[model samples]
Target: MPVEPDCIVVGGGLAGLACARELACRGRSVRLLEAAAASGGRVATDTVDGFRIDRGFQVYLDAYPEGRRQLDLDALKLGRFEPGALVAEGRRLRRVTDPWRRPLAAVRSLVDGTVGLGDALRVARLRGELLGRMEAGGIDPDRPVAADERTTRAALEARGFSTRFIARFFEPFFGGVFLERGLDTAETVFEFTFAMFALGSACLPAGGMAAIPRQLASGLPADVVEVGTPVAAVEPVATVERGAVRLADGQRRACRAVVVATDRRAAERLLPPGSLPATDAGVTRGDKGARMVAFAAERSPIGGPTLLVSADRAGPIDNLTVPSDVVAGYAPAGAALIYASVRPDWAGDDAAAAADVLRQARGWFGSHVEQWRPLATLRIGHALPDESPAARRWRPTGPRLAPGLFICGDHVTSGSINGALVGGHRAAAAVDAELASG
Candidate 1:
């Protein structure tokens, strides 16, 4: 508290922590301030009755090129969910597995017409194309997913995929990934994510998603990162009166430079109008948020480490999973845990939505759903940056807000853990350059 650092990082999420750490490594004094009781922003976990419930359903993808540079996968000890999902039909569920991984289940799905052979083949074809594009730097996040502005549906149709395939599979599967249906997000996001899956398995750390940021922070000095330290404002140009950060308690902390790494709304609130170079363009704020309800079950309902996709898409529930199936110690003695999610924007009122979800889930597991107990609900208001055509076309202009001010977050880049880490390092590089020039 007594030392005046060269850089002050606001919002102790992955981006901010990464920025602070990088600046410290460069031999510049650094201080990271987090408003919340803990870091990780949206990447948080809750321990309820011995079960760890993550904030919404999030996966630590090992394939994120940027994240791989920042984290050691082997040290995290990740657990994987099966390659494919169980698509839900009228009232029953059909198991669809990756042909390359689970040949028998893929063949069975083809035989049962659960997933048309043409569609299955198309999925495989797209996988190859994306992986190739990613390796060759053709589908970089810097490059828009689509060549021009168009709906994801249009892109899929142009690629020759049928409407049935898009409605049934892409909606629940990727929609769950994007958290919005009708391909409202950029097709490029879908493409990059697909390539990621093709390249690496979807995984969770042995501890939980929170371990991600904790690991990043653990390497830094203890006093450098401060949790529960809310920042109320930032000075545009450092002055004797206004130094680096204006604390919520009316105290000012002076620093040679300041990097604000917070969400869209917080960034808008903290900085002066039009100070954010990356967000000044058509960056979109998602109107929808993902609601995750964790349940304690008597046993595994789906019976495997696979996500159950809702083909109907009419019900409140989008998909369900048993975390216990993916990793051990998720439940108490002789019990299991189930994670259910719904797009609340589609689902009706709160009571109606919960009722509809439980009822529809009953359709899948029969009366056994009644035995499941509702435990926790995590609602992430700003889950994703709306990747519209204009938004997708966005590229970083520079990383300077003023002589010594900077900004970084998912909003500044691709909108993922990878984007955050990449953006953080980018900000650090800018800070290093400016400080050196001085």
Candidate 2:
């Protein structure tokens, strides 16, 4: 008879893969099960007609501490975006570059009224403050909510940013990031994200976001992670001091411990009832949804890799970018790949959303927009966990749920690539300690 594995990791997403890698490194045998035909969970990509389309608009911040430690950055062949954004102001686009990075562009922004001198000074001060925080032990994923902590919008207002600046710049820029336009995400998350952008570049891997999970799984043994295997439930065998995971197909796999590294909803379903408290089980009131529509164009709209954010609230499109401008491989030879992010409210009807996006694109890119062919429309319901103040108040749940059952995911930490990796590492350490004590 074959020997059972030391641990079985449920969900082969980044968190699960990271957990399995850590366990294997500690000399424990691990088996990871994933329901999809491939891993990566929400961070997936599809190739259609020579255009690479990520499930939703996503980026890899090179400054993520866990990412720096876990991933081989150079191996992914990252394509970087310019340090600032192009704001759509009225009938024209205004270039806004980081003053610290590009003084010439910053001066031009001031001259063109993209940002007032006062706001420009405030930006410098904000950048310095965030960078200082990063240097001073970095942002803690599990930090308690400070008494003065407020919503992103409130925080910006407290920092003395004008209402016009908030709406013209911060709203559309971060609206796409948090998948919500209310700017209700926690202030800590906003600070952390700002620090990351200040410290490093926001990039896309040559092979799309899927390259991240693929690189993580590459270090593990071939038989360790099994895609297309859905885990039905996790049952603890107290008498034997072990656990068994039942698969959707009725097969049972026994292991010393089990790690539920799925998303918030899936994790709640797989674990036993009452295993998690109401706070942890319902940490996020609801998941944030997002939509992205990609079109194949013969020429680039912006002619560069900088992001274009719409300041107009009347339009459905929030932001636009040409992936091919950053990485040639994203589109076939001589073709440009345009990705337009639609407002969450507009994501319901694909046909309507695409039509509205095209209408708006025509305003920005002129009549040439008519020649752009639609490539794909991706509507992601669970694009990110809620990061509102109420949700963030609850600290991340500990990894251990029972003697042999544990859980880890982005929901258990802050919502980001770094948070998922941190959760995985923490869970692996907890499991290793429990097994060692026994």
Candidate 3:
């Protein structure tokens, strides 16, 4: 007899897991299907030779409202990064004071010679402009506005910031966050991210970045999760007999509803012909955002794991983090691990890139880095989620071509952990509503 689940949630990433947890909590017999051996998808951690290496660099931005309301942080053992950023420009290193800290740090940052009077004034002016925009209803938090053309560079330069200030700080900092530092990313994104930086500190989970999804999965009943199960496709039929999902293992599962919470490209493959409507907003299918490599060092770097953005304009390595300081158990005694990313534009020969990274590190840290051993260079495709301001209204609301099939994941909402969680919650609610309507 083919097994039939009341609800089948496809994809075991955070979004899928979140949806499964919600449904299972509601007492529904839900089955979570994961194509991978384990869950966590992009947010995974690996235990290397006596050390922990996160697949990539990811941090919580201000405890997003969706995650704060839905996720159980206690279960995850979340930890925060250091308060302020230690920036490297030329041979000189400086600390960028965090606004949440004392007023003196903010004042010192302004008066400091490192940023120069002009740059300091620009920073203050930009800060005021952002505050004013937020206050005057000039920026709508929900609606995606067309005038949001502020990229990190444009914003900084608009305030008369110097090239040195941008290259050494904003470029690296925003590059680490937005992948393409030169990208004309939406201004709203820059604003929201700046707000997050101001309001919250960079944080990681004790076990690893994977702890986030693991914690969400912990909320689900063990019997409900079915790993290594690939959902072949979802097809919509007639009323009452509506939709069906076929698994790759030659098993057909009947479901009253389905949540396709995998990657957009993967989700599209599972849908029946013409099921998805033609619209500008669909699951993004292309090269994953960028590739990153993670290494475990025997000692901490110059900044002690404070996130560093390489000041080099053409450099391949975008961001750097010392895991030892960000989270306690990231490194064993007397050792540290650092995760570095090679932007998609920066990908090529791994060996050559690694060499370049070491060379660049030597200059940025003011120390020799050639001695550091090379570890796994995790080729993380689809790293960043699509965070364009225009795609805010693309959340899945109606049924997929397959009668009971639905979709979730970063593509559904803007591709952050919070977006994934919110999408999952929305999928669960939609299922509940559908069940009630019937």
Better of 1 and 3 by TM-score: 1
**Model 2 accuracy (lDDT, Cα):** 0.86
lDDT (tens digit, per residue) of candidate 1 on 1-438: 448887899999999988988888888888999999998887887889988798888887788898888887888878888898888877988887778888998889889887887888788888788888898987755432444766666678888888888888888888888777768666776778888877877888878788899899997888998888999989877454324789998988888788989986798799866685454444555545788778888899987778888877568787888888887766776788888887645647554555677888998889999998888766677787766656655533546677888888877766788878987888999988988888
lDDT minimum window of 10 residues, candidate 3:
392-401
Model 1 poorest 10 in a row by lDDT: 277-286
RMSD of each: 2.5, 2.0, 3.7
TM-score of each: 0.93, 0.95, 0.86
**Per-residue lDDT of candidate 2, residues 209-316 (tens digit):** 899999999989888989999999888555455788999999988988999999988988888876666665655578998888999999998899999988876678
User: Per-residue lDDT tens digits of candidate 3, residues 185-240?
Assistant: 45666775665566567788888888888888887877778888888977565534
Candidate number achieving the greatest TM-score relative to the actual structure? 2
Our model 1 lands, by Cα RMSD against the true structure, at 2.5
Q: Which portions of model 2 show Cα errors greater than 4 Å?
A: 142-148, 236-240, 280-284
Q: Considering TM-score, where higher is better, how would the candidates rank from best to worst? A: 2, 1, 3
Score each candidate by Cα lDDT.
0.80, 0.86, 0.70
